[model samples]
Target: MPKWRIGYRTLKTAIGAALSIFIAQLLQLDFYVSAGIITVLCISVTKKESVRASWERILACLVGLIYGSIVYELIGYHPISIALLFLLFIPTAVAIGAKRGVVTSVVIMLHLYTIEGVNVEVLINEILLIIIGVGVALIMNMYMPSNEKDLTWKQVRLEDCFRSIWKEFASYLRFGDNSWDGKEIADAAAFIEEGKEMALKNVDNHFLRNDDYFYHYFKMREKQFAVIKSILPFISTLDRTLIQGEKMASFMEELSQAVSPGNTSAYFLVRLNELRNELQQMELPQTREEFEVRSSLFYILHELEEYLLTKKKFKPDPKRTKTVSAKRLNRDHEQRDTK
Candidate 1:
């Protein structure tokens, strides 16, 4: 039974449509069913999107009503008029920022043309129906269930991917073999991008001025991942016998364990600095080939520093584990109040 249940947002949207349909019917609107259809069309995953959709729909509705009436009057409700209406009026609506409302505009044009004439009474009826449909959708979406946990879940998965990738890199450094498929790198990248998008959407779902902590977290990781990618080719060429290769391998193995939101990058930062200083203090390369390998080792240490500092930007609160988004929002609100 739970599996068959509709999502909370979808259920709310359906109820919104039902209420609009009832109101339109009670008022005896000519195309009463259109109200319900509009509600369905306007329901979006976030409140900001719902508002944009409503604006586009209403704008397109107006554009279609005005030009559609003119076309209907000139060409007498024929197929040629319909074709002309779409080609001309649709582009005009897009130019006016109603691209998402093209279908809704077409429906409105068809409705007007089917009625065969436009009068003050008919135009007012359409306007009232639009109000009911868009207004009800707004009411339904003005609030949302707290979704900080969703962001937290996404963050954990993303970190897990990062950890896995690092472990694979460490394995390659230790064995000097490409036994592990590189698919997890792409998967982790895709997850990071997806997590960022979801976090931004979560931010828009609320009216409160909350910071999107997860979005920033993913962005930081993405920057660090870029450095990691740059170092991979160097890792591929080096053997365990090369300078710092074994040490770096050991570093990655331990680093992978701290890849969670609660862990700070300070420990890793200190360790990488120590490694960099140690590498600099070593005697100059005895051979030309050793010089290149030594240079690559130094470069890898610099990249590791960049990667670690990126993770240090945020101070993750353990309390954020529960209702993170809401808490951040409230914290911001209080800060504003204090100021």
Candidate 2:
């Protein structure tokens, strides 16, 4: 069973609709109820989307009014004229990237149809309705709830998944334990997708600046995850009894513990280079099986290096960190005061 809950968006939509209707009614506009419907349609998940949708609707409504008026007057203001009006209106709206506003514009066209023709008073009333409805939606969308906390939580979860995956890799290398169902890989991928989406929404919320640090961070993790997945087949093909596997397992365990929102890749890279050097200096394999296992281990190391290099180019967004810290401090203060 599913539960129904009123989220912030739903609340905003309700308030925006009511406010639009109230303003339209207060202004004595005809078809005031249509303003509420427009508000409902205009409210969007993100501020950017809301602004774009409002623009599209406004532009489409204008086009519909002009076109519908000409068509209605020329074609006798009959049902056939309306069909003719819509036949071109839809495609014209789409061409102008105002498809979202087609329905709203249709409402205006109907108002014109109801009045039998266009007039200054009715035109003003419809324009006022558009302005009031879209304005209310924009105002309601202005207070988009911050996604910083959600993004931060996702970042933490993604890092934890990475750590778990690395530990699983280490366990497999050290004990030949293939018991890990590789769930962390899937979980990390899901987290990265969710985080990227939320980060994009966060960026959309900020009009004056780019909040794309979290987005970049998630992208970096995505690259590293791909590398990790490539290393899996190599790991599974390895001979558990190989001495080289132990050293790689130890390195992976250390690397797993060091996963954080900081640049420690350089240290790991140095250690990895040293491990490669030590492997190069060792005695050559005595048989084909040993050579094959060593080759797979080498490939695993190469993939691990690629994984760290992906993170090497990434630097945490300091401004985002500070903003999040400030928000947390304010929240803490509020909690203390309430207590």
Q: Pick the candidate with the highest lDDT.
A: 2
N/CA/C clash count, model 1: 0
CA-only RMSD, every prediction: 7.5, 4.3
Q: Estimate each model's TM-score.
A: 0.82, 0.92
Residues forming the 10-long window of minimal summed lDDT in candidate 1: 320-329
Segments in model 2 whose C-alpha atoms lie over 4 Å from true places: 318-339
lDDT for position 320 in model 2: 58
lDDT of each: 0.81, 0.88
lDDT of 1 by residue, 121-192 (tens): 888888878888888888888867766666676666666677887898888888876887877678778878
Q: lDDT (0-100) at residue 5 of candidate 2?
A: 96
Shift of residue 164 alpha carbon in model 2, Å: 1.2
After superposition, candidate 1 runs with Cα above 4 Å error: 1-5, 143-145, 167-187, 314-318, 321-339
